[model samples]
Target: MHEWADFSVEEAGGRTTVVVTGPLLVSTIAYLDDDLRDLEGPVQFVDISAASPIDTVGAWVIYRFAAEHNAEVLGASEQAEVLLEAVEESASTADVAPRRGWFWQRVPAEVGAMVFELGRSMRRNLGFMGAIIAALLMLFRHPGRFRVRALVRQMELVGVTSLPIIGLMSFLVGIVIAQQGAIQLREFGAEIYTINLTGRISLRELGILMTAIMVAGRSGSAFAAQIGTMQLTEEIDAMRTIGVAPVEALVIPRVLAAMLMMPLLGFYAAVTAIIGGAVISQVQLGIPFLTFLSRIQEVVPVTDLWVGLVKAPVFGLIIALSGCYQGMQVRGNAEEVGLRTTRAVVQAIFMVIVLDAFFAVFFTEIGWG
Candidate 1:
């Protein structure tokens, strides 16, 4: 027989009663916690008197149940109190907050909650930065354990596997850019300049941006999923409990691998996109291959390539950082792995675009293309 069943909380007259029947297990305690989250109002008192055979798990269940619902434990048994004490200690260590409601509050709680969350995010980032520094220091001490073969695998997966998709995407992008430029330039009888426009814009900006976005979705999410799974399985914790540092074991290799590969991928993407543009110019504008290539050379310079190449590492760093950070933060089970994976992709993509914009503005001012 499993522990805990038909768990319900109800109010009668002046007392609140939490009823549970059966032998509660760890899973049941987690379920009870969900039930506790649903409660409302200012509780005058709580009656856990009907609960039976309240062992350690049962005691944590009852304590969390009451604490989350703002209920006071009334007429508790000595065993129950002991159980509550242990649970409370754990909860305190976890930084769990008891439910508290304002009495006829003037300000809306949601607005305050938003500010609170923002502050919490800032704090989390600070903590993560400290952890990162510590991880880096640990990695510096022991450099040999990081597997070059695993890094090569990561590089292939993140960089090489993304080629076909990026090729097709950039090809379509080149077509669209050329079509749009041809339309406008043809009106001005400047159709020949379409080669110049496509090559310049693509090599300098769109190539890097598109490649970064693609990698964030593919490689970034994979990093998070891999590390998060390791975390969920306690492999990360096991590493730390031994002499190995979790960050050294997991993070540095991924970061370095991504940094090394993303630029190569970006270069491949740029070349393919230029090739894509050449195909369109060859077919649509009746321009010869040599003529299109000459025009691209005339307009796009070495600085254009340099600008895009330099941004690749930044984008790679952003993706790797977000992925490894989210991965390390994962808790519980597979659900957390999925959640952190989504978060890594989303945050990495957003940061990539933002950084792309920064690069764009800087390159424009510097006359890179």
Candidate 2:
């Protein structure tokens, strides 16, 4: 019948004692906060033995009042004492400030953390590479171990299915190059040189580079997503449990397929690009298809074609390995699969561009440029 969470004060010997009574629950505690804050003079003690069903919020309020007055909490029941102790512990922890170093001082720590992460990544990737190589060796020793059916299936998926899109993209790129080159060269009455420009650039660099980038975005991401999903479903673990090497059963087929098909795809892309350049030359520059072909034959060396073709397998290997590595790194659920897939594409594309730059420099130095 009485009000909950009401307090009474008694003054004695120049000190004050606050006695808290009634239910100290959320519903009643808010009304007591103002009363607690309004209490004046040095408080001797807070007696809460009469309080019923004290909760964390009520305990925290009483703790704060006692702390402000440097007053002891007396007459608390065992349960209320436990709640007060917990609140005190939490408050102590919350009051502690986190230590921080200056930005410049933390640079070394940040660099070290980055280096550690990079090293871990490299080690994991190298382990995956070693597994694939070991599997290959095993397959060579026992030819029956090869997954011929899987290999053929992946080839169709990674190569044949990709042709239309790759061809269309390369063709459009070639047309743009030819049209832009003609616009620039026409100023000097050298529009015919567009054929030479398109042929040389497409065969030597753009053809394979664009093809690899597209494959990295398409098949590479697919590889990561597929393997990542298998991992999420524990299928990879099941394969391991059954003594089936996942590298051989899953990774090798995809890697071998990509490597075998990349060169063919690059050649196809180059030819399509050349045809597109010829068409654009005829239509936009009035150079005639025969004249464009004749110029390409005379100006573009066979070594340029070989250069692009040779880079294809290496690019394919990088993309496949990057994808599979990221896939294997995936843990947890569907969101992790998506993140690893995105990382695979970005990493594969980055490596492709970096290798292309290195190839450019090496070729130039060796007179292959």
Q: lDDT for each of the candidates?
A: 0.80, 0.92
Models 1 onward score TM values of 0.69, 0.76
Worst 10 residues of 2 by lDDT: 90-99
Candidate 2 structure, TM-score to reference: 0.76
lDDT measured at residue 16 in model 2 versus the true structure, 0 to 100: 83
Q: What TM-score, to 2 decimals, does candidate 1 have?
A: 0.69
lDDT of 1: 0.80
**lDDT tens readout by residue for model 2, 27-64:** 88877898889877789899898888889998999999
Which stretches in model 2 have alpha-carbon errors above 4 Å?
Answer: 1-100, 365-367
Q: Each prediction's Cα RMSD?
A: 9.2, 5.1
- Cα deviation at 271, candidate 2, in Å, is 1.6
What does candidate 1's lDDT look like per residue over 138-158, in tens digits? 656866665678778778888
Error of 1 at 107 (Å): 7.7
